[model samples]
Target: MTRYILTTCLCLFAALAQAQMRWNQAYQQYINQYKDLAIEQMLKYNIPASITLAQGLFESRAGLSVLATKGNNHFGIKCHGWQGRAVYHDDDARNECFRAYRNAYESYEDHSRFLAGGQRYRKLFSLKVTDYKGWAHGLRAAGYATNPQYAKKLIEIIQLYKLHEFDKARKYDKFFARRSKDIAGKGGVLHQVFEFNNNYYVKARRGDTFRTIAAEVGISYRSLAKYNERNRKDILEEGEIIYLKKKRTKAPKSYKGRLHYVKPGESMYSIAQLYGIRLANLYKMNGLSPDYQIRVGDGLRLR
Candidate 1:
């Protein structure tokens, strides 16, 4: 009986060691795969790359957790006014709903925006980019995580992986500084444009006019309106999505057969903008009339 108990203890120890080795290997792979994205987020949002990576490692378990693997929810963000698909999982609460993404890159982008755009995390941006410790603690103080040792764990991960080095890279500083100037011209208007589904788009800010944006992007207002399926005389609203190229007839395969639940103040045009689909196609896909009124909680096909 004594010999059997000793053998069982040895087996358990070996198994635990092997699991640790696998976890370490996974963590290393995760860092290598996403370090560039983390750096990009840091340049764009002023968040520390180390803190982003450490939080990703902890929350997603190096992208191996069910929420990360199945839902592409790397940061474990919950559905707060989310207009897209969602998944439920037990996380601090049972069957909690988390935001789902089209891919891991989308998850990373959303995570950066989630922290940068939130009122609670505004103070974190005041800290130096290299101040990973302060950021880590500030995140905890802002109720980012429920764990008492959340800050300690983030610091430990940062130190162990030397993730802070990414933040101190001079090359990124020069690159982003030049990029920022080009994107945000005189008057602080963000004229930055990005491409998705082979279409170019710029987010509209307060006081942005199609004529102004057309001049900045060197595209005609007529062409811009045609591309976005809007009338040339339409007024641009703050935070509205303006496409510089034609939207796709169908959404990406990942969104096939997906239905969007209309929220308050969301129109068919807004829903098309959200999914990057052509406005006419959106109506056709759902067999709705051009003047169809979408009520709150109504289901609209997105594919």
Candidate 2:
């Protein structure tokens, strides 16, 4: 009798696990259908497509939740400033006020813009899409959800579903040339040279790890490690100034204004001259674009 009981428990457990796996598989299918829309929104808003998709999947339970069925709110975004339509649904317990969208696309667009327009998320925009870890942490810091493990859950979903690849930029012109016709038109190409103090520093985004910045800028990680006064394994802080070459660095000058998009074959020297600003001033205001080799469509601060 004991053996039979144990066998029955094992079977039940296996069945439950299988059911859970099926649910996850179904959720992935839902995400796959909307992957392109997510990527498009990410490109326009700088939010990682993975985060957007994960939030949608989790909150809507792969579109099986009542909120999604009735209201089309995949992320459970509240009606804090909502002026459109509102719906109440049982979430934590009592019915909660949620924003209602006309369709799923509207929800995605609102979520992306919500993060982008918020001042708290402004710092996160400086990060690259691949730096989902930082963005995950940032979201938590910005109070996206109440759960303590929110970032971990989102990261797990992204990895399990291979959503991070959406952020990968097409560096090869030929590859992007074909992609441009299918996707968004050809990506802009602009090269920038970031010159700082006596030495030059590579322009870096928030998502750039010290190791990645070092590798891209052709400096030893150890050298960068020593210069930044950080441990070799330490993640880099956004806007933490460091020199590409080993030398004493000076405080960068700050320019107040909006960033201008760099065009193809544009140099920092020419950009500065065109804006009627000193090259050094322009370099200090911006970090990564001064390197003289900038990609087209990259934003440069003009003010």
What's the TM-score of every candidate structure?
A: 0.51, 0.49
Tell me the tens digit of each residue's lDDT in model 1 across 217-261: 667888988888878888899888898778998777887777899
Q: Clash number for every model?
A: 0, 18
Q: Which stretches of candidate 1 lie over 4 Å from their true place?
A: 1-23, 170-303
Model 2 CA RMSD to the hidden true structure, in angstroms = 19.9
Once fitted onto the true fold, the runs of candidate 2 whose alpha carbons sit more than 4 angstroms away are 1-23, 169-303
Give the per-residue lDDT of model 2 (tens digit) for 67-109: 6777777788888888998889776668888998766667777
Return model 1's CA RMSD, one decimal: 17.3
